[model samples]
Target: MTQTKKNQQPQPAAQPKPGSAFAYAPAPESRSVVDIAPSYGLFIDGEFSDAADGRVFKTVSPSSEEVLSEVAQAGEADVDRAVRAARKAFASWSALPGSERAKYLFRIARIVQERSRELAVLESLDNGKPIRETRDADLPLVAAHFFYYAGWADKLAHAGFGPAPRPLGVAGQVIPWNFPLLMLAWKIAPALATGNTVVLKPAETTPLSALFFADICRQAGLPKGVVNILPGYGDAGAALVAHEGVDKVAFTGSTAVGKQIARTVAGGSKKLTLELGGKGANIVFDDAPIDQAVEGIVNGIFFNQGQVCCAGSRLLVQESVADEVLDALKRRLSTLRVGDPLDKNTDIGAINSAEQLARITALAEAGEAEGAERWSPACELPSAGYWFAPTLFTGVTQAHRVAREEIFGPVLSVLTFRTPAEAVEKANNTPYGLSAGIWTEKGSRILSVANQLRAGVVWANTFNKFDPTSPFGGYKESGFGREGGRHGLEAYLDV
Candidate 1:
């Protein structure tokens, strides 16, 4: 009969019994690899120096509430000192050949790559994001940012602004705690590449990585005073923003603070850019690939435990398949492991602080009080540190506070639309215009929806993707000024 035998698929691997026998063994990364000192001094004029007033604050690991180190608290006087140092360094730093600057940047990028493992471990320990994310996303992006801007250092003349572009005098930068090193990269890389010296402020809770970066500056033999780092609370940041010597200012934090900086620098000669908050919308159509969409939904909201400014906190599903997607997403959420940030298998980690956790709880409570359906996966959180179970409110509407506010935690507000036009309208109803996501099988629809979106960044068929080469910022109240790519260079140059 000449019939061919049917091809057989490989058999599944055997699974162990459901008990300690099948449990994943603890594979925590060694904490000793990172040398967190008992206390750290401010990085001023390229050297570690105490605050002028001898004031210092403690920084602790959010995961364990363990004290990491004491950091110098910069006051108004320290901010002035840092600004003057930057201004003085600006002359020589600006006069250096673009090629010379490129060398320094390239050296810094290589050092970052070499010490990436140590930095990754430190980031996880301090930031409460999983080691997997720090290793896979943050470190690579940080190194790439320096490398990307390094190429731009010598090539600015040909960047199409003009044949000759001049540098801004001194850039004052303040980065948030969410992605400390990456935000620092976004601020420092282009500023340095464009021939400006910088005075940077690490958030109060997270200052160790930026302090380590000062050591990198020394390793590169970067000129003294070219890069100054101040680790302190909001008063220090406010003072830096108010400093008269700084020619340019860049900040990434909450919208409230961004608005305050805008008001503080209003009518001044200083150039400013603020990358602020978001309530991104992740929309799924009936024809979307359901499995991939579910994964994107989880990643968009739950990544970094939803600490990201551009996290997709709002989910819009087409009514035709809304129930199907919700069912699938809830099932997927149950599979996620949430616990120790150092665990290689952990999908979610601790909330950044008790204050942030309380905010999340209050907003979640509001969702339930306003008659929305509140649901969370049954997961155990460590009692020692701040934690919030990943949650979703399925009955949210545009009128609800949960749908309007930026929770800045791992909480999703689900809304449904019957058509693409309605989805677009509902998504744009919010005051935020930071980022959005759309998933559909139709190519033309992707283009159409994206064109209608007011957000600065949009993703189709994917979520939470970033590149050093792409420009990132927001529209409306989400704040302004692009932070990456060729556009970012313009913010630092006087063309």
Candidate 2:
């Protein structure tokens, strides 16, 4: 482990009393459960095949910088092939009885549950997120999404879109590296439930889980060409989006790329939905419970190394309680563990890539340059692997880039507000409005403040919470269209 800079160093932990059992034993999750192949090919027409140009890329583990596998890099030709396959399968897949489709979805969900442990470990390895999070959060949500959409398979008529909702034929999906499997489930499950065939592209860094999912699809006896997984970079994603055979496009990525995708599909018959970037505000009120609010604040920004699209990167505290909240929040951050993604006890882990770590370091430096006071817990990062400390910036204003831009890191910008109106104003000051968190004990205040917030999803007294039955998206530059619940189905259906 390497020490951080002296000025930004975290305070050392107090020594445990001798012979006391207060210290935690290392409990690293074994990595043997996940078996990586030497090389992987694109899953097209229900079979693995080399890219047309025979190009490939290596996906490395962010935690150890180990090359996990070599995966096919899809090109324009590969994208066209996938779209053609999906187009060919659409008639048969959309013609299937809705209940029959439900059975296939249900089978996939059950298999996901049975292999949950394996998938969780693999995700932790490939994505560099803590095992605790993969085991507890991502995998369960993936399965739940499948099950939730399966239940709606035969019941789309009752979903209120129309008396009879129609499938959109083919869906082209692009998911980000963060929460790779969960994002894939979010895009794929609903499309299949609504009887649309899919050509999905996983982020280049985290393509393993999607390939694993293709195997699951085959195990469930899904028809050939119903689901195709293309592992590639932005060029392939562009090709997929521009393919004429695709009737719908769903993308979860950066706001910049989402805009490009929107333009590519614009003036065409393709339906489009984008779940993009965010700078969510977690507002702490004077009346909120201090300890609970601190935990919520920590979870909001620090979970997944703050790689989340809807992470609460901005913190707004009432002037009356700002001092108390800051003290408690800093103290809590000091105890968080920040190493070894496979460790069951790890609270923070590596950033997803060296490129991402560089971006985070640059932005955090910019925050300091802009005169925001920066602080981080006294945590040692590993000598190898990409890592960034959980950071906080005090004395931030809406004008500060740290408070305004999507840093997309474990860095929070603290701003103080005098009243509820001020808090709402500061929270809604950004162009992105994907989500927001409000901490208060009063129910009426929760309802009143929530109604005024411009974000797509607002939570009272909780942060970063998600459910399959709830709709989630954003207002403004965060991107349009929801991705869960009955609302999610609407994106894949023609009413």
Q: Could you say which candidate leads in TM-score?
A: 2
Candidate 2, lDDT over the whole model? 0.93
| lDDT of every model, 2 decimals | 0.91, 0.93
Per-candidate count of clashing residue pairs (backbone under 3 Å): 0, 1
Candidate 1: pairs in clash: none
Please estimate how well model 1 matches the true structure, expressed as its whole-model Cα lDDT: 0.91
List model 1 lDDT by residue over 1-495, tens digit each: 122222223334436676623445555666656777778899999899999999999987888898878889999899999889999999999999888999999999999999988898889877899999999999999999999999999999998889999998989999999999999999999999999999999988889899999999999999999999999999999999888888899999999999999999999999989899999999999999999999999999999999999999999999999999999999989878888888787899988888888999999999999999999988889888878889999878888889999999999999999989999999899888999999999999999999999999999999999898899999998999999989999999998
